[model samples]
Target: MPLLTNREIAETLERYANLASITGENAFRSRAFQRAADVVRDLHEPVIALMDRGDLRRLPGIGSGIADAIETLVRTGALPPLDALQRTVPATLLDLLQVPGVGVKTATRVYRELGVVDLPGLLAAAESGRIRALPGLGPKTEANILAAMEALRRRTGRFLLGTALPLARRIVADLQGTLPAGSSVAISGSVRRMEETVADIDLVVSTRVHEAIPATVAHLPLLSGIVRHENGSLRVTTHAGIPVDIVVVDPSVFGTALIRATGSADHLALLPEVLPSAPTEEEVYSRLDMEWIAPDLRLGLGEVMQAKAGTLPTLLSVGDVRGEFHAHTLWSDGTATILDMVRSAAERGYAFLGVSDHSRALGVANGLDAARLAAQRQEIEKAQRATGLRVFASCEVEVHRDGLLDFDDHILEALDLVIASTHSGLRQPRDVLTERLLRVIANPHVDIIAHPSGRLVERREGGDFDWNRVFAAAAATRTALEINASPERLDLNHDLARRALEAGCLLTINCDAHSTVGFDALEYGVAVARKAGADPDRIVNCWPIERIEAWLQTRQT
Candidate 1:
């Protein structure tokens, strides 16, 4: 047996907290458990080690109650509270919690009244007009739930990109070492494209004999079980439960094999042509008199035509980003101090850093009020003076459903930048959400709109809105849209990002970092930008500080 990763343990606690919330537990107690998960995630050491040393109680935010819960999970692989709640709340209601707008109260109402047991059941109820009859719910909410469940179905059983990428790379590296010197191995499929969710890791090995694959793969250390082995491919599950597929081919046709293997299937169908024995992917494209496409852009979404016409835009790279506009510090909910985050950005060779903590409208994020915002600005300027790095004070002002920002004009006008975001009252009608966002974008003080879609990757569905209208409003108002780089919320995902580009909206790739290490998420953002055919010319963060500062001066009311 292996010790559970810190993230795994924290996630288990988080689910327990959610379950507790639905099972009629005290609100404060449930929040405490949720905070404990955050504490464990932030701690650098292996939490299991702390338990073994009997020091779990000493960990910050770990009270005796949480400590006991942690110990039970580590020792027995289950939480007693969660187990008890499952019996009381029924597995069906717990499953319902996975839907975005369907909260515990709503779930409870539906469960008691309609006995909604699963997504299909919920979908049927909503479609048949049964859900609208529940207390506090109406036709609009039923539609929202119906859409959310549809989105959830598409992502069911998929692994997050961040988790799957590293594991896939490690497996490829290990497999490379096991093969003969002449052979080469590469990872393809969704891992290569950086899709938010992946079904399985795809591996392609260019080696002489197809029969050579299974023997070495069979003896690998991590292999827990084999799913299948036939026709030059093998399917297996790792001990960690990640699914993997291996495609073996001869080295002579390595390039074509890789291109075919790294496809969306639909993307490959649009390829001008495919040929064997192309030494490299570039050559395959060159053979058809087309420009090479980024692996991330192989989405069957007109890249082929763009290449043929020589109109393919150069995509944004991690190297192009120069600053961040959405970051948090201890003044808000961030784990890092302002100066620490600034120093990290400076060390990364960034030209500037924007310390944009959350505004008071979002109290759950430890958002700052006007006074705290002013105090934070002073601290940021002090750091700028000492570190010789440009640190701009900014705020992520909330866009209220009533079409107002969290801060007044007087407060917002004082900041170097304002990133308006949607946080509270997200479950509004499509027209209402669009109008609220349009209002934020139109604010002369707001330079950017962070996480425009308000989607949490695979976890939550994007709020229903008229994005075309939002994009048109952002363009008209000169409000740049943000590509939030956080792994959990890579908002402005590839598809919508491309659409934003077409709508002529300028974009910014920001880390929305909460800690020093969060800057690393910039790479993921760049990956998304590239996938969407975005370029430095349209990404404001790619500009030098002088340019960005000059642009900021123009946004003031």
Candidate 2:
């Protein structure tokens, strides 16, 4: 079979999305396709390999049908069902979704209501004032539609970090395996800096021979085509449509090339000096008379000045986290039981675990009522004795639009911790949402917020709250914000996490673990934390048992 990338698999899932959207199928059915696409698109390994290893089902969004479709695509390079779906949906109408404001529903509505089947048609409709007169759309939406169409025209080819990082790692690993024994390769550019999106992956290499590297890269398992192969650099697209650039130079110039490649253009402008013959980034920084700035801090965002001033933060590391919080069990929507969750946290060497199952408001999650909460406390006490791990029986209480918590005050005060958050009404107006969040954060019983933004990457946008105001209220109330690492919800993304920290707000980087294996996602939170310049001293969960206990006492009634 020819080389097949995960991109091919993702495209097939998209077809399902198109079909369901046009036919007005339920949201769940269309979302399955979108979710599956997200999983495959962000996956670092080729889908074909996962299919071969029988590991497809372990992924979050892949079910049996999607897995079968992936296998079919890998084996035959096409899916018959997807091809058929494409036939019903006009290709031009589907293309309208490429514009910024036009979603599947909006595109379908325009196509049906106004016979606007493409970008040009949609633009004409908006320009002629026909779009604003449609049932759901108004002037504001029409203006956005026109602007988004223009933005789409100007948009460049860039992959979201969630989609590109995994694939980039796989490609570099493949190159490392194929390169000559003494060759050295390191990722450069936005990937190294952990940008949310990037146009391409850049790699810097030092090898015994120059031509040998490109020839070797061309034959990597995922490589299907080459764009350019030059004396110093090579550009190629993986079978998954991820573009990569590899730059090879003599060992002496390797460090210089690396600094050049890892640059943000502006950062490189700060120093015309280059360090050659250095094997690592540390040496480059040392030669330039500065501390080694972390790659995430190399965004030319005043990091150089801080590096020179010796005030750069000692960022948090994976080893710093001492507890697990915001987890779930069978008491709520989670699949794991309380004991299983406790044991899993214990295995990871966590000193404490906060089991915050959902409150009774979320019917779908099987959220616990006050009686169920009291019973859960008994189980938690038993687990603490059995596992010898600190167990904090808690509830992820939902805050209603009117600023009321799911549980009463007495119930909330009795718990070890209260994680207040918004589960519904995410699309409320900014002032209303911010006020409700402020009301929750100020509650003496509330200790933390889970997935503060309520955003799911690639699936949903974050709520439109005034983050600065929320951060201010949180700082005053001593409410710790969360850096949720669900992959789908890396909320308070690195950027916002950094801003919140600067605003004197503390944060907890949590896996939001739903199952035993979900503990592995803890590292993703730590990555987001480090990228935000967060330090162990400020991350509540990274504190020692003594500090955590003392802090808990300050907040607990």
Candidate 3:
């Protein structure tokens, strides 16, 4: 049996939930499985180990039934109920759910009503005008579905960074345990660069015993099958359906092989035609008379010339960030209490933590009204006194369609920080959306714009706003634009973030955490800032607490 990572376990549970949804089983049961998947995925400890210790049921949302299903999966590598459900539906029907706007309900309707079992079938149905005549779906929905299909087609082979990185790390850890002691195994390609989406995973191995690799890979539980093996390089397919390329090289040319595998073609093109054989990347760059470039900067951009000129800007790192200004507690939909959040922040060496629960406009999240917001502050004060960690009382207030904030100025002014975000109207016209953002940026009480694009990577496209105007207004108002660190929403992506800095706008990288484990996502946000060449001085949260407090005071006045 293969060793299942937490992500794989979560994915297995999610598959059951989706299958249940398609089978029209009890909706509550499906949701319970989905929530269990969420908790398992975010767990710091291994789910299997918890099961081994008979502590799986202690996890929130893990009841006896779900716990038993997990045990079956761990023990036999199969869930009988899931296996039975899979036989009832066309396997291809689940492919329709990958399209952005196609939910399980929509997929079920199309599968039952239109016989649309896959992306191509869904596209054909939408194009033929067959879907418009359906009971609830109109012409607009059909058109949107077609658009989503087109978008999905453009990036069919890519997986989000969040999904691919963890899998890659798990593979690396597994190999470290199983491989020869002196072997060097490291991730390369876009996964190392931390690209928002990766086409494939790459591993560069430095080992003298090349013959041992193929035999060892055969035993790696993470892989489903070997794709190709030749010339000391192996390609394998993960159980998650991702392709991984493993290039084994002599320890003598390991640096050369890594350079060949890691860099973009254009980035390599600008370098010397002949390369030197070295064991370290620093030596490889030194042989070429260039500075050691960070992996994220190897995007074939101007970094090559900058490296030669010795003028690469000092990029912001995860450690440079002292704290975060956008996070949540149980005051909203968050899973942890204020005290738990503060203790987690303290563990991470954060100087201060912001408790920005959702505002009343976001009713689905159980957003806090004015009274609830005030009551939450009392808890925040208690947490601060308990932990000696400065807890900033704040709210992630919503921006209405008409550009008004969810809370009045008087209420917002009383908070230590105010993060304005748009929960709806993301599809508004360009002029209207840009205007809405401008209003939020111009608000004296508004300190930051969270997840400025409202985009979910590879799922939904972002709003089409006039960014130049938005950046200019933000520069004038000193409103920091957030690079939300959530795996699904790394908004103010590197390109936009760099442009925002060019327009003199301040930048902030926040986790937008909903739980204690949520802070772990801060690294993704820092990746965005580093890719944009942002400095710690420009990120307000990276400043000392006194300096951050002074800056917040300036915005209020």
Candidate 4:
């Protein structure tokens, strides 16, 4: 696509920064442009407007070169130098630099020596041992490069919550060891809100630990490789192949830093309206004066107004969750047995655990038929009686390709909880998908809608349900929306969760765990819900045991 306007200029500059970072070019020049682009993106007034007013030069980090570039973009709608560079360096060559280990020198060498540009060409060269033949490139290095590239592809141009969460946890743990006494640390941003895919991982540490950040970050077991370390921030790649960035700041500024880093960018842009004159992030939240709002709740949809008016819905936190709602067992694609699942929940101090094995429609998952489901329920009841843990017999009943529940009403009525979900036919027209979902919501036996959107982060496309209709139906039917916590499927993403709440729909954060290991995945779902601005009161699982039982009973009636 042809680059046009200030936005395009900003994007082109970003490209320049990425290329510069990869190629080992003049680092300061690249950083200057990147920072300038960030400033432009964050500007409330249009870049063109700032240029027309001759005020572009006044913005920090926007030097004479960037000022001239902005003016050219505003006037001629193009950057001649950037265009000329694109011609000199094949666009394909630039793409090669996107590979994790590919440097500018390597990219230049590949283009000059092997005439290889782009991923496919590079892959072929690596396979043919041509990449290993390059000076300073060994066979093992070439293999590692190829492996990294493949991992990158699977990552789908985004960070997976599954990988990022553990690394963040480790970093937080390490910070505890290095920080001054009474220091606090947390993982914030989309990871905190439980989005399945993350662009970056953000950590906020409150410490006199600022001075020790470098050593703490340097020693992290996850830091198999360090990409860059500047100031108090460090970016590293974990042994598990996920990239993470850690920022260390003082305790007083922790809230502001958390808010700043835990941003959707779009959400942060709307903040000035909430606090017209507050320049710093701390001031932005302090204007309304509540222990700064959590990053996941910064969705910009009037959270600030609610905070100002003292009507902000109390968002759900990790502690509010009382049970595992959408879990599986050996009966249907889960690694644990019903008894094992119940025992694990009890060990975690949960008041209840919902055993929601897959229903028969998900044949590939070895879902349970009525006979098996009945047996599983009996087993769960036996386990509950023996272990003293309340085990709710639930089923993740699939909404078939034809949009009907996997189990008939008779079977659904027998369950303690039924979480209806769509496992196929995601590409149906919006209206059809909406109607299909409405039917499931209206089914008196279905108590919750699991992973309503059916997105698998960057791997699978999301469904086409008309959210307005879906949320309305959920509200009317009193069906809770499940925030599936699996890293690959943090479906019912933050925005949808917010809309669900606005429409008076209840939300539940579920691990959708297939194994005991998967039970920890609730963090991701909670992160998405937090980002959606969900409060503890709106999340049914956060309720006390009696309250949860009452709610479930109400759904049954």
Candidate 5:
């Protein structure tokens, strides 16, 4: 029953369309498929449901041909035409389509003329002086391909943040149990920020058991591949195919160790500016007159500027978050029940929590309609009374293509909050999208816009919207913007958060958590907020219960 999610379908189609376009197969046909894929991926409702209702054709970008393809996939779980096309084309030629300078025609020519079926074949052809003879591909192009091939080999089997983060966490957990008492371990780098791709793994472990380093390294589970190990450091490949380096350091130096381990080389290079004479990593940030820059924000763009201006905003820390805004329960796609989600949030010392389950538009999420929403609300109210905690009832409502909300006005008004978002129709013209979002923000019931861009990082860049206008509308409407903590979708990206903050819009760092484990994703969101120069005071959820209640009430009245 778990067919490909809309996102997956869209991505596959987009890739195919791109390959087709680059190959000059049929520009219009390629564009048609690509646009349909984009629309399908962005739609809030399940594409399968739309197909079933004969509404797929009604969606923008979905013409008769694309609609037929979608219908076939929904019914058969495969696209026969796409499969046939793949069989007819060389997979290596398809891969070549991903290369920066390589085009589809070039790939086709290389395959047909030089017999380059794979990177190895391509490399061999370039080196054997056969590729340079091809039209449009000269010696310089050949050299470039060879160099790229080398880099590709090195990156092969590498782990991206999505894969590496979980493995790193498991390793840290295992190390904590085996290391001497009082030892601490944490993951650092882009993994910490929930970035999509990661170059390497950097871990900081604090332990008094120096003698146990080798044993710890040797006994580590998930080490399917090992690269090398030396000193108090061991570099190994995880079962997930990522290279990780675990560094064991003294507990007293844990903070400094973390700073050094989490460094983006470029960000570290600027350290001397703040600490012209200071010797240690910890001293560098302190000397620069700023708190230590979190590893995720070490992109080297404005850390120096903020330090010099002494106007760096106070970033949200784990303690600053007062509630969980986006969560799921047994009512929808979540694994936990409503009470369980509340209890878990309470354990984290949050003053309040918002349960914003998916609305009926998201059939894949088992989204709740009016009946289920009302039943869930009653149950939540009962849980709130028993637990003596405030639970805000909300829904992650989908904003339809026509610039309207998923739920009726009555349902929206009945909720404590509404996180209006675009789940579909993402390929709309830029102005149309802006107007759509603006209309949602202006809705009295909607409080925040979740994962504004809907990007899945590395996999796809979400639709581009007018940020200045969006922020302006948000500011005027008093609606907050979400910095989704899901490592895969850190929407309202750090840079955008900074712009939103400057524009005087309130911001919320929510886990958009679907389970108890997801509730802990707050750390990732906080890191993103900090990187964007977000101030704790400007964050709506950071406010105390009375203030938060007041803010929500303001939206209501």
Candidate 6:
């Protein structure tokens, strides 16, 4: 059986859960699968290893049934329950669920009552005013469906960076063993550049035996089938349906070939037509009298010019990050307890960790009320004393639609860190959204604005804000804007991060972790900062604990 990553397994389980819901299966059963999917997705270890140890059900939400289903999926690459449902439910209904507002209930309603089976049919019905006339749905719901479908259409063919990167790394790791001693292998193209979404995976391999490369990859368990094989390149499909492109080149011109393959078409246009052969990318850049550009910054957006001018900013790296501030614990929806979370941070050699659970307004996340928040502080104090890690008390306070914060001013002042974020009403008009964020930024006690855009990659669009006004307000207040490192929501993405830096705003790169393994996403956040040409000095969380504490103290006063 081909190896399945945790994400792939989680996605399979989630699909089964969604299918069950659409088919009117038992609600508790479907939720069990869904919750199990969430647990598996956040896990740092491979699910197969746990299964090998007969401990798959040891996970929080996994029961005997879900464990069996996972084992069946890992072994056979199919879920019997999901297959059964596909026979009864129109598979197109699954596509309908992909729309933002169309949940299982809504999807079932439309398919059974309105006879709407897919996006096109739904769009047609909405345009014809048939959907609003349904028993429960209104004109507002129809408009929302139309808008969501339009947004969904724009996101086709792209896979999240979170999904594509790990798979590429896995493939590259497997292929690395096949290479001769001195040969090289690496991920390239957009995946290397750490783009938010990717159309396909690209790899560069340097070897003496080009033909053997294809023979080796052909046997990779991850590959479903080889799409095409040529003299210098090969294409294959994974079981999860992502495309892979591999380029093999002679060792002599490996660097040249890699630079060519790792291009943004526009970035390549700026280079000399005929490139010199070199053994390393650094040498290639040296021959061209330019600095070796980090892959994330090779977007052809003045980077080449900056390279020539010797003016490229020193970019932040994963190692430069000292700690994470926007993390959750058992006080909220997170699985890990405060002690476990602090221990994980300490194990990572972090000088400090912040326990920023969700505030009262986000009840779905088990957001902490003032009393709960105060109680959690006792736990934080206990964890800090036990772990010898400086644990900061904090809250990811909600920014209401009307511009009020979830916590009162006095409550906010008592915390070591306060992160204000918008958890709902992201679709408000441009002025309203901008004003809402601006108000939060201007608040005296709010230290940082987390996930400024409130977007999930390929899932939903973010708020339409007057960024100029927002950035200006944040800069004026010395408020930090977060580069939320969750692969699903790399909010304040590279482009916006650059603009915020240009506007003199302080930035923070946080994992916004919900579990211990969640801290692994810090690399993605650092990549965002690097892509924005941000220096380590500009990121608040990159500071030493003493400096960070001083800054927090300043904010409080």
Candidate 3 stretches with Cα past 4 Å from truth are 1-96, 108-147
After superposition, the stretches of candidate 5 with alpha carbons farther than 4 Å from their true spots are: 1-163, 172-189, 192-196, 204-218, 228-234, 246-261, 273-280, 283-297, 305-313
- Model 5: lDDT of residue 323: 85
Better of 5 and 6 by lDDT: 6
The candidate that achieves the highest TM-score relative to the unseen native structure = 6
Let me know the TM-score candidate 3 reaches against the reference structure. Answer: 0.84
Candidate 1 per-residue C-alpha lDDT over 130-248 given as tens digits, one digit per residue, 9 for 90 to 100: 98887679887887888788777777767878777877877777787887667788998888977777898898888876676788776565554457988888898654557889888
Put down candidate 5 lDDT per residue, 1-557, tens digits, no spaces.
44555656776677677656655567888888888887875565556567678888899778888888877776777766567667766655667755545666677688778766666677678889898898778876776666555545544433445557766887788877877677777887657655556766778777788777766665665453346766778776554345678777887666666666676767778665333333344565676667655556677777767766766555668897888778888888899988989999999998788998999989999998999999889988987987777999999998888878889989999999888878666656789988888889988889999999876554335666898999998998889999988877878778888899999999998888888988866776787788787888988888988988888889986
Which lDDT value does model 1 have at 75? 79
Candidate 2 has its poorest 10 consecutive residues by lDDT at 271-280
lDDT computed for candidate 3: 0.88
If scored against the real structure, what TM-score would every candidate get? 0.78, 0.78, 0.84, 0.63, 0.66, 0.85
* Candidate 4 lDDT over residue span 1-557, tens digit each: 32233345567777776555544455787788789878865553356556667788889898999788767765776666566556656566677866766766677677777888688999999999998898877676687567657756765567787876776787677666766676777787777755566777777666774676666666654454457887877786554445677776776666667666677676678565333233245565766564355555666667766776668667667777888778889998999888888888877778888999888889999999999998887898998998998888999999976668888888888898888989877767788888888888888899988888987776555776788888888999889998888887877887788789999999888888887778787777777777776778889888898888888888776
Candidates in order have lDDT scores of: 0.82, 0.81, 0.88, 0.75, 0.76, 0.87
List model 6 lDDT by residue over 390-494, tens digit each: 999999999888999998999999999999999788878899889888888878899999999988887778889999999989888889999999999999999
Order the candidates by lDDT, highest first — what do you get? 3, 6, 1, 2, 5, 4
Query: What's model 4's lDDT at 473?
Result: 84
lDDT of 3 at 184: 78
Instruction: Give one digit per residue, the lDDT tens place, for model 2 in 398-501.
Output: 99989899988988888888898887777678999999999998888899999999876654567888999999999988889999976768888998998999
Residue 157 accuracy (lDDT) in model 2: 67
Error of 4 at 333 (Å): 0.5
For model 3, residues 1-557, the per-residue Cα lDDT tens digits are: 76566667888898889878876876798999999999987775566668878899999999999999998887888877778877877667678888888888888788878887778888899999999999899887787787678778776557888888998999999898888878979999988888888888999988889999988887786775577999889998676667899999988888888988887777889888888989988899988889999888898889988988899888888899999999988889999999999999999999899999999999999999999999988899999999998899999999999999999999999999999999777778899999999988989999999999988888878899999999999999999999998878999999999999999999998999999999999989999998888988889889999988888999998
The predictions' CA RMSDs to the true structure, in order, are 6.0, 5.9, 5.1, 16.5, 14.6, 4.9
Best by lDDT: 3
